[model samples]
Target: MRILLWHVHAAWTTAFLQGPHTYLVPVTAERGPYGRGRAQTYDWPASCVELTPAELAGADVDLVVLQRPEEWALAARWLRRIPGRDVPVVYVEHNTPRRDVPDSPHPMADRDDVTLVHVSHFNDLFWNAGGTRTVVIEHGICPPAAEYTGELDRVGVAINEPLRRWRVTGTDLLPRFCEVAGLDVFGIGAGRLRGLLPPGTGLYDDPPQHELHRQLARRRVYLHPMRWTSLGLSLLEAMMIGIPVVALATTEAVEAVPPQSGVLSTRVDTLVEAVRWLIKDPETATEVGSRGQAAVRARYGLDRFLAAWERLFKEVAPCMSTPSTAR
Candidate 1:
């Protein structure tokens, strides 16, 4: 299959591109948001190729995967073909609705043209998709080769644009965890948190995937402070790296973190206490983390993720033929 998609979510796209498909990512001279081509921070497969808008017009794209609403119009303009009408289309909703909480209607709600794919059941429940077809495909990742050392007693967190997302990302709640142990934050815009956080908190801005995984494993416990989000891939990555997690009992965190694997609670104090205990008790932390690693590996295996996508693709475009180059 030949899939047309933008380089929107690098981590998710990296996993998706691992399947037996030829992925077409748009690239511009400026390398803007919509045209990032292949991922530089994370490794993607060779099957993922970059093409300009003009080049794509001639490329026979078999399927279109939309991430944002604006991409609907962009697809029509760039390919000169309307999605759903001209080619099979799937919109992967990566974020939870920001407005009106549970009552907020999804931006793509009631749109019969495109099928909506949610990353978590929490997102599926909160979003009012109306009559639009919807399905939940939980996050999956290739487990990192690095094993957890937990030599550092610091807490590790990964979030993008934390200052701007603030409360939504649980950035404001970071200070509470900092008191328990030093923190090491890794992500885009993380460098800005240097002076703002306490003396112990260390900030690493947009480190490459290999470095990020290495740094995360050194921390005693992984902290997820997101108040609202479609389940974060970083959380899954941490678990896969054999790091015990402390996250709020909200959204998909409730489901992702299995029993005896990690601690989850609505109360910030409980989570703080859990981290404090986990930091002090390395033996218990290792045990818990191992359980998490086992559970996540079974639930979100790359094979399972790719198979689900394959089933969906077949349903959407049963008649579409596979290219010779596609796996």
Candidate 2:
């Protein structure tokens, strides 16, 4: 099947290329994380083709897959003009939107032709959109074999966007924890901290995935302070490397990590205590890390994720071929 995947977010392209099928991606004018538009191109597989929006207009595409809700208007317009206009469209929600709006203003929430896929089961339960075909597909990680040999004094934190007054990410809590625990934090969005964080905290505007993984493996513990959202990819990468994680017990995190892997608590005192405990007891920390690794391998491996996607594709394909009764 000829599939057209629309990924506004750069990371989704990495995962989309894993399937053994012909995939088409839209080339964007905006530069990505690594560098200038020339420096950071997507690492697409041999089976995939990158096309311009104008080229896509004339191509014979089967399915238009969207990774975020904001892209619904664009997909809707594309669906209306494509030859097989009734082709199946899928929307994958990577994070829960700000649902606290007076009334949920999500346009595709009630869309009949669009199927919603969530990255976490917890997200599916929390997001209330009636009459929508919703499925939970958890994020997967590449398993690690060798144990990490990095120093334990460093703690790694990653955030794509800084927390504004409207959105909260637990970044506010990091400085306080770092000060109390005497740990060095390497992170993105350091500007968000401005005068809050002490000296010597490593900050980067952007880093490649391979480099990010390398840095994360060196850290003794991975600290996630995200107050509202589904499980972040950074947390999974740390767990896969057998690095213990200390995060807030909110959103999908409570369901993603086990008690043995690390401590999950909302209390500041509890988090502070957990950080200290993990730092002092290397053996216990390693044990927790091992459990996290095992959990990720068993539950969120790539093979399992691809198999689920294959099954979903098969189920939706026939629906696309059938004519709707509305017409």
Candidate 3:
């Protein structure tokens, strides 16, 4: 099947592209938000073909995958087709409620043509999708090689715009984690994390996805202190790479990380203690990290994600022969 989607969320889009469908991403010279095309920082496959908005106007898209609400209008204008009615549609709910908690109205609320897919169950519960058909397809990742060498006595964190997001990304909590061990932060605008860090904190800007994983796996522990937001792919990737995690007991983090995987709690002291322990006891950390690796491989595997997506596509769109890679 040929699917049309804007490259709104890189990590999620990267994982979604692992499925067996040809994905069409909009490309622009400026490489703006809705037109990020193929990821340069993260490796993506050839199936994720980047075409210009002009070219996409005539593309034979089987299904349309909508992430941002604005994409609905863009899709109609670019593809010359109404997303849900003319083309089968799936609106992926990436983030939890930001405004009214239980009362915030979803952009796709009460829509019958589009199926609303939530990344986590927590998002599904909190979001009021009105009468739109919704489904919870938990995040999945293609596990990187399990290289859990906790030689570096540091806690690694992955966040984007930490300085801008501040407490929301749990930037305030970094001081607490820094008390136990040296800290290394990686992600977009991470270099801007200057002055926000404690004495031992190190700010490293986002590297290529693979390099980031390699550096993060070397750390003794991974810290996920996000107070609000959807589940971070960083945490999942850390677990997939067999890094013991210390995350706040918020949102899906509580359920995603098993007890053996790592420590999940709201108590700052408790998580700080867990980070301290994981850094000191390399053997125990390795054991717990291995448990997390296994759990992620089983629960958040690529095959399962692809299957769920394929099922949804089959339900709404007819099976057409795969498109040729040639332009």
Candidate 2 has its poorest 10 consecutive residues by lDDT at 31-40
User: RMSD of candidate 3 to the true fold?
Assistant: 2.4
Pick out the ten consecutive residues of candidate 1 with the lowest summed lDDT.
Answer: 318-327
Ranking by TM-score: 1, 3, 2
For candidate 1, list the clashing residue pairs, or say none.
Answer: none
* Cα lDDT computed for each candidate against the true fold: 0.91, 0.68, 0.87
lDDT of 3 at 83: 81
User: How would you encode candidate 3's per-residue C-alpha lDDT over 132-231 as one tens digit per residue?
Assistant: 9999899979777548798898899999999899878998888877878999999999888787677657888878888888899899999999999889
lDDT of 2 at 185: 40
How much does candidate 1 score in TM-score? 0.97
* Sort by lDDT, top down from the best: 1, 3, 2
Displacement of the residue 13 alpha carbon in candidate 2, Å: 3.8
Better of 2 and 3 by TM-score: 3
Number of the top candidate by TM-score? 1
The list of candidate 2 runs beyond 4 A from truth reads 30-44, 76-84, 101-106, 144-147, 163-167, 182-188, 191-194, 319-327
> Model 1: runs farther than 4 Å from truth?
322-327
